[model samples]
Target: MATKPEGTQATRETEAELARFFARYEPAIMKLGQALRAKLRQRLAGLFEIVYLYERQGSLVLTYSPTERGFEGLCSLALEADGVKLHFGRGAELAKADPGKLLQGRGKTVRHVELRSVADYERPEIEALLVAALQLGNVRPEAGAKGATILKAEEQKQRAARRPTAARTTAARTTAARGAKKAKKARS
Candidate 1:
């Protein structure tokens, strides 16, 4: 993938948002995720990227599509705490294309291959799967069109605040009562 010009505001924001997303995972997983994403960008140069950061689930997903909707994605990269997965959106259609049964998942629509490193993406079988997926999506990479990224959603895990103990609550009330008494006395 060509390096995006650093001066562009959109590019800077996208990089920063992605950086924050990667910060949630372990170093090794984060590194693998970055490498996998770079390889995907290189392989699918002109496809629009729709990103979803589900921090509550500890997963970050990037879907490459001909259009903006993720449901229209040709393929997706799912980065979780454990590792990364390359998901073929139309895996059911590509089952015959993958005679080796490399793709996992029994769902009717999607199937994925667990990716350990960037090199896994370069494997012949995976490359073939990608090409087949593109064809299935009926998308051809537009010449000289480096796709833009759209951050669809970010769901950060919400931490509940600790409730005050009964003793603390009582003490607080007592303090407030004493202050009120002192104020009344002063006014009198």
Candidate 2:
């Protein structure tokens, strides 16, 4: 049998991780997220590195950066329950020329637009905004850079607390402990 190419295992693992992450969402939401990711990859093909980030807020974010592990991201696609959002990292810098007023945010730098459908990706104004943000961020893909890389997954402590399964587990443990103490008293 032909040996697998180097890094193939890692790639498969990343894909599996991403799939598992997406599986947490509803089917409709997952479909929208996948479409949004595909559109972004197609638009920025060969021009930037797509970094997958499992954020602390339970978001699976795809960040476009000039370099792998870069300090700043040019833009990002955040998967959400209703749909996906495109976030411009240097939105504050582009606000002055934002004729469309499509970006929504009051923060110092970041701005975002909710993309509810695939048609949103084809808008000229959105394309312009993305290009502007990329320019302002000074993001240029390095030679021989891979098209995408999935960063190591991050697990948030807050998420565990909010999980129903975790709550059930805690309740079960407490009940078991109480039952054990009652049985010991009866034996005594």
Candidate 3:
């Protein structure tokens, strides 16, 4: 029997895993994820190499690193809880000079900006922050590194997940009731 090559099987598994992960989010979130991904890839093009890592906690991270295996990351785009965030690995240290005060978190070395809308990507301060972070990390584009790269893609064992919060559930129910009422009135 001819066995399929290992790389082919791995690629298929990764695709399926990504598909499954994406299916769990709302359409709006998926659209936002696509936009953020494109924006970041464009902004960092020809710079650090991009790597997508899917976590067991149901978060997808796009990490930018100088070397394939080296010290901490320069920056990363994370998709979580129906939103996208841009994380600066050494954010805490940069907080002192952050005029925009957009970076959040109290971690020793990490800071992040939660992007509520696509417009966040256009803020001048964001680009400034990214540049500062790259400089701080001492990251320089490789001689011929011109684009993003996917170094690893995989999913972990599934676990029981929590349901949406009560407020969201109530809002959904109210919307459905209003929709049903509108349909009945139209029929009358």
Best by lDDT: 1
Query: What is the Cα-based TM-score of model 1?
Result: 0.77
Summarize candidate 3's per-residue lDDT along 137-156 as a digit string, tens digits: 77655443355344444212
- Against the hidden true structure, what lDDT does model 2 obtain? 0.70
Model 1 weakest lDDT span, ten residues long:
154-163
lDDT of 1 by residue, 2-83 (tens): 2234358878887897888888889988999888888888788888888887755878998998877788999999989889
How displaced is residue 32 in candidate 2, in Å?
1.1
Q: Report the candidate with higher TM-score, 1 versus 3.
A: 1
Better of 1 and 3 by lDDT: 1
lDDT of 3 at 150: 44
User: What's the CA error at residue 59 for candidate 2, in Å?
Assistant: 1.9
Total clashes in model 1, counting residue pairs 3 or more apart in sequence or in different chains: 0
In candidate 3, list every pair of residues with a backbone clash. none
The alpha-carbon RMSD values of the candidates against the true structure, listed in the order shown, are 10.5, 8.5, 13.8
Runs off by more than 4 Å, candidate 2: 1-7, 47-56, 140-145, 155-188
The residue-by-residue lDDT of candidate 2 on 156-188, one tens digit each, is: 334645788888989999999999999999999
Model 2 deviation from native, Cα RMSD in Å: 8.5
lDDT of 2 at 145: 37
Q: Estimate each model's TM-score.
A: 0.77, 0.69, 0.64
